[model samples]
Target: MLELRLAQGNLLKKVLEPIKDLVNDANFDCTPTCLSLQGHTPMAFVVLSLRAEGFEHYKCDRNISMGMNLTYMAKMLKCADNDDIITIKADDDESDKVHFVFENPNQSKISDLEMNLMDIDSERLGIPEGEHHATVRMPSAEFSRICKDLSSIGDTVEISVTEEGLKFSTTGEFASANIICKHNTKVEKAEEATIIEMNKAVSLPFALRYMNSFIKATPLSNTVTISLSSEFPLMVQYDIAEMGYIRFYLASKIEEAEYEQ
Candidate 1:
């Protein structure tokens, strides 16, 4: 048996919005201390971690993995109001369906939905720990806007980072553009500041489509952290207040000329 209650139901909604776009089905692995999901496509990989303490109520009889279609779950979540309290219940031993309950703050309204679970076979990928060449922390809204604007100009973006700052560059048939954000700690709010830590300079090209898809998580956090290294995939992370974080990883694109060599 397992159950979890979250006062801020919108967080789950926001988490699912981007995931459904990238992955169709996934397993939600729940343990006593945490609930995590990892899904990926050929172009991008995503990992979501939510700590059990973040929930108002959390219970688990044993570790279990519940497989379901993300799009279907997102649709059910859409019926809930932002202020609604959400409770999820599942039986590890007996049930093939997961139950979701939504209740208004006043307790004047309540709704329940159940969706069938699947037996999905998936293995969690182990992400190795390594230092990034450049780590940039900036406002989430700023990153979203940059991806959206760059997508309009080109399908790929060259991200370059130096001691000075971070730069996003793109080129189209008609024109090319570049946007640079400098490091600055002087801000009214820390979340609004652009901070960069660079161990070495690195420039890599990535698909803008995946970047835009990752931007759907902008609503979950005020600040976004981007880590880039020549040896690893680009990582964009959004930390959820005190709950946990969602991370998206995309591999850099190699030029045709480089491939020929």
Candidate 2:
């Protein structure tokens, strides 16, 4: 048997939104203390992960890997009100269908649905969060605007991070643009401004599409951390209060010749 519960449906909706964009189906690796997911985008350029700990109202009855269709589940989840307590139930390890129940204590409202599951093969990647040469922790809302603004002019954005601060830039055939954010900006609260550390400066180009997609996670967190190094992939993480966190990793774009001589 497998069961999971959350205090509210909207919280569950927010928890799963970022993953639905990149993955249609996934296996929820459920344990007594946590429920986590690990998967890559269709092209494998970006790796997305979600980690939720079983604390407070969150609970896990028994360890089980529940294969689910996230898209259909998301659709069904919309029927739930923000204050509705959401409960997920599965009969056993071999259960093909899972049940979702939403109840509102104030209004005495109830909604329920059952969805069929699939046999999904899940692979967990060994992505280590090693010491980064350059790490930038900035307000997520600001980062989202920068990505959205630059994406209109170009498909790729260049990130340059140094001990001083961070720079976001992009260029097209006719124009070039750059936005510089210094480490000590008075416009931001001491805790909200850009914080950076580096041994050597690092600049790399990443697809704006992927970045814009990542920015969708802003609703889940107030701050986002960007860890960069020449030897490792770019990592962006958003911590969801006490629940856990969602992380997105995008490999730096490398241009190559069409034919080798």
- TM for every model, in the order presented, reads 0.96, 0.89
| Every model: Cα RMSD to truth | 2.0, 2.9
Candidate 1 scores a C-alpha RMSD against the true structure in Å of: 2.0
The TM-score, computed over Cα atoms with residue i paired to residue i, of candidate 1 is 0.96
Tens digit of lDDT per residue, candidate 2, span 7-91?
Answer: 6467778767777877788887777667777767732333433344533354566777778888998999998887888888788
lDDT of each: 0.92, 0.77
Q: Among these predicted structures, which one has the highest TM-score? A: 1
Q: In model 2, what is the error at residue 120, expressed in angstroms? A: 0.4
Please give, for residues 47-158, the per-residue lDDT of candidate 1 as tens digits.
9999999999999878989999998899899999999999999976656999999999999999999999999999999774699999999999999999999989899999
Candidate 1, position 243, lDDT:
97
Model 1 lDDT, residue 163, Cα:
70
Clash count of each predicted structure: 0, 0
Off by over 4 Å in 1: 255-261
